[model samples]
Target: MAVPGAFVSSILLLLASAAVAEIQFSEIRSDDRPIIPLDDFGFTHRGWLELNVSGIALSKAGLELGNLGFFLCTRDSWLNVLKELEEEDITCALQSSHVKHVFTFEKLGQRTSFDVEFDQEDANQYTLIFANCLQQQLRVSMDVRSAMYNLDGKSGRRDYLSAGKTILPRVYYLFSLIYFVLAGLWVYVLYKKRLTVFKIHFFMLAVLIMKGLNLLCEAEDKSYIKRTGSAHGWDVLFYIFSFLKGITLFTLIVLIGTGWSFLKPYLQDKEKKVLMIVIPLQVVANIAQVVVDETGPYGQDWVTWKQVFLLVDVVCCCAVLFPIVWSIKNLREAARTDGKAAVNLMKLTLFRQYYIVVICYIYFTRVVVYALETITSYKYLWTSVVAAELATLAFYAFTGYKFRPEAHNPYFAIDDEEEEAAAEALKLEDEFEL
Candidate 1:
């Protein structure tokens, strides 16, 4: 009798282990996606989501829900309901949101499955939240698959791309073409003025080329993701180009502001210090930008990465301005106390114009465009992006035009006639003294 009892106990223990093995309550992301943000929000015909669940045993996990297994709601609604769920239960929160997708699991300890197709609505961020009305007690594991497809043929946007970002691919392509054209024109100018070209001229050319490639890669990356929800390796290329473009652009801006190659052949100690600070900040900003772009709201630490990106970007913007201020002061003092006041006046005016342009670019891109995005209707969301690109293009054109290599350029170098006149006057005075 004792031997038989031991054998029965071993069998019972095996059965219990097998039963609990199905309960996977950990944060393993292989199957269940608890939170999904609907970036592709629209009004009339948003899209469709096909949801499937398998191997779900919510009740066995010690959840005593009357009927609800899971549900979906707008992000705002989700945030609002959390406090209620903590104070009361999931049912209390459910009563407030009638406009939600609710799924029910009724069986107990059975491997049950249910699939649903929902027509998504609302022009707000939607989220998918799994229901544990009584709060999950056991670690339950389940398989869930969700696929979103578009039904609006007129919008011409894939379901994966958010409505506000629908036109980004086109915008990137257009700007990439523009940058390529400008780069070709710059090459022509450089070849024509090869005798007067400085190292800075080539650096500008490189920046233009990098900008074009960066935009091209970005266009491809967004286009692919919009179509298939995957970058197909374009994202890697985009990241590389984006990193190179960011570093080069800031470096170019700082170098030009200090007149490193044109006004002077080498950087001053302070100028070098500015470069050191700005470059590292740019690197941090770009890395944070990459993290923000790659991670959705559902991803861990997404908001933190976005905040880091914004902070570092603002710091880099402020740091770049210091060199420009130094340049303006030097030009102002030269105009006031030097013999070539008129020449310095021309350079001073150029620097001031550039300063204003930089400030306008930063302000419009950072503040005004964000405000536009927040307030603009969903239909007109792409306009903010267009405005930003337009501002960037204008800034680029103005900087290139003002700083182009040329023989005895008035703003960049002393006028040849002015130099000749000063030399002749000095020679005449020396002859009179002899």
Candidate 2:
């Protein structure tokens, strides 16, 4: 009875082993047969299969099936998956089979899932429907988490290149180049003429050159972004350039204000002193702004400050116009009293200068308008800015040439006849006094 019982137990054990083996083989066959249904986020898919599994034998196929599925899935969603994976420095091995596409995802808690689907569209084209499903799942998860964590402080946050990376830097670079070149030419002319105005002109030129350099740096940064597919290193350079640009703009305002005061005889002493103080204060404020901007709530978006200062500049320019208008009026009155052709001619020249100032005022008004529009995120306004700036530069250059003493007299030497006549006039005046 004991022998019979032992033999029966051995037979049962053999039968159990065979059953297990058959089950394992069935699972392997199921994994090898690749027709996956994919559904996610308003999208559904059918017909995707795995290829190149000939090396994966039936015995060990179950253990390798999950990994193979993941590899295939990742291959299907390669573009989107690559972006996230590269950010985390994760890499996966992949081989594409013409039969089907694979989708894979690594989830929380070290869990991974993947699916394979066959291609119905084209034999060569295998779509990764599983990747789309995974992407939708991630999106939904993120949305739910975002809703839970939604707070006022975290609202409206954005990245650096949100304003469209390529265009702004390019526009700035081109405009800055043009501005610097024009300013440099103006400075050169002032220097050659031995004009006392050279000091202010040089300062303005330096400011424009610095602005140009900043734009060049920005362009280089954007180029780096295009090359590397990243904008990680732009912030430091951006902040440095921002601070410098503010300082330069402040200096420009001061230099122009002071030069205008020197050229205009009618400005009150108090006004002149106030302008001097304002210029330095603005410079200091701009320096402080750099620090404040870095730590402040507004952060790098403080480009709006450019518009603010430009508005102030427009106001100051308008104030300048008041004095110019008054001077022109006074000149006209004086011309009526003097009635001399030379005096009238001088008044006409001065009138021409006033007209030039008017043109500049219009140009600046347009600039302010465009600047405000830009601050408000109107990109097309820059075209107006460029046009107005070019016009202003052209008019300024023309006026500078027109008013130049050398333009009227190339040699700039007093004529012998005029010197003799002046000597005779002086002799006559002395005789009359005697």
Candidate 3:
């Protein structure tokens, strides 16, 4: 039994009429992500949405064809478009809110439909804009069932996300636990030694505590966000701790590189004033960064402020290097003139090398991680950051254990004149320490 020619002709005429009456769309390939949406863990965001639109149709439900215009929208900017469209006699639902970029198809294309793709940021909602160009009363039916991505595993990429989902939280949490243990042990050591003043022991303890808290924030950022599928407030703490870590790094290098006694007797006031300025500036900068993250695309002012404060922090960190390097050189030269101080000179030289290594390792790993995670989208490099921090901490712990403090000791090997000056200055100083 063959179908009649008249029936086939009638069906073709109906399709042609439908195309003229309303717009139609077909979805195409967008991102190569797996079925599960990847949680960005406070960095390195990536995803996309693509769609193909069939030709528009002109039908008389209640208004003229010339009054209608179709639009595309994404989650964040959809509300703006919707409010504007409503003022223009268009009513759109919030459900139709997923367009980051817009594409217009020529009304006279040879193909019946065209495709449009929107790169996903932190948004996921989509919408279509319908308008009455002539302000005439009209109603239209749109076929939008196939407009979004087909999440039935037919169009998305193969599973690269599942492994990340499972492994990332476990690894981050493991490191966090280790940091917590290290922080606890350091606290115990501080308590036992009765070193509660703003001395080197207390300062290092503070650094260790901040590092532990930072690791915990990272772990929570991964686990809770990945599990609940929403961001938490720990992100702010993460940024704050990160900047503090850099500040402490600067302080640690200066303190260890130039021995506390020399700084205490000669330059305590200058160092304290500079540090007071630097620490507050870093805190404010880090706070701005957090505000920018919270405010998203609308935080340009805060972003600029953050960049400015970051420059301030950088300058402060760099300035500390002068005092550190100068002190190291002076001490090394003084040791050379007196052969009796050779053993201490060797130890001092070794300490200098170790401190330099720690600083270099930290900055190098930070740059690598930032490039890989934020710029290149290689999220696995987060593990490298964790490993580097752990190794740095281990080095610090070993050094501190080996170099216990002794009273009236001359581990720094300064010249006799400098020693006499330091002795005289210490004798004249008040009991209050810097």
Poorest 10 consecutive residues of model 3 by lDDT?
31-40
Residue-wise lDDT of candidate 1 within 1-434, one digit each (tens)?
01123222222222111010010112213222323231223333666666677765543443444334556554346445654555654444444454375565553345467778877655543444454333323333566654554545776554565555666888999999999999999999999899889999999999999999999998998787667766788989988988889889889989988988878899999999999998888888888977655543334455567668878888888888888889888876665566675566567667778778888888999988877766666556678878888988888999999998877665446677775564444334321110
With a 3 Å backbone cut-off (N, CA, C), the pairs that clash in candidate 1 are 23-139, 24-140, 24-141, 25-139
Per-model lDDT:
0.65, 0.38, 0.45
Tell me each candidate's TM-score.
0.76, 0.40, 0.51
Give the per-residue lDDT of model 2 (tens digit) for 153-182. 244321122122224456667866776786
- The alpha-carbon lDDT assigned to residue 128 of candidate 3 equals 36
C-alpha lDDT of residue 374 in model 3: 34
* Candidate with better TM-score, 2 vs 3: 3
lDDT of 3 by residue, 41-117 (tens): 11112433344545444333333333233444432354454454546533432223432223432232444455565
Q: Stretches of candidate 1 above 4 Å error?
A: 1-40, 43-46, 52-60, 65-93, 102-109, 112-115, 121-146, 152-158, 411-434
Indicate the TM-score of model 1.
Answer: 0.76
RMSD versus native structure for model 2:
23.9
Looking at model 1, report the run of 10 residues with the lowest lDDT sum: 15-24
The alpha-carbon deviation from the true structure for residue 394 of candidate 2, after best TM-score superposition, in angstroms, is 4.4
CA shift of 244, model 2, Å: 7.0
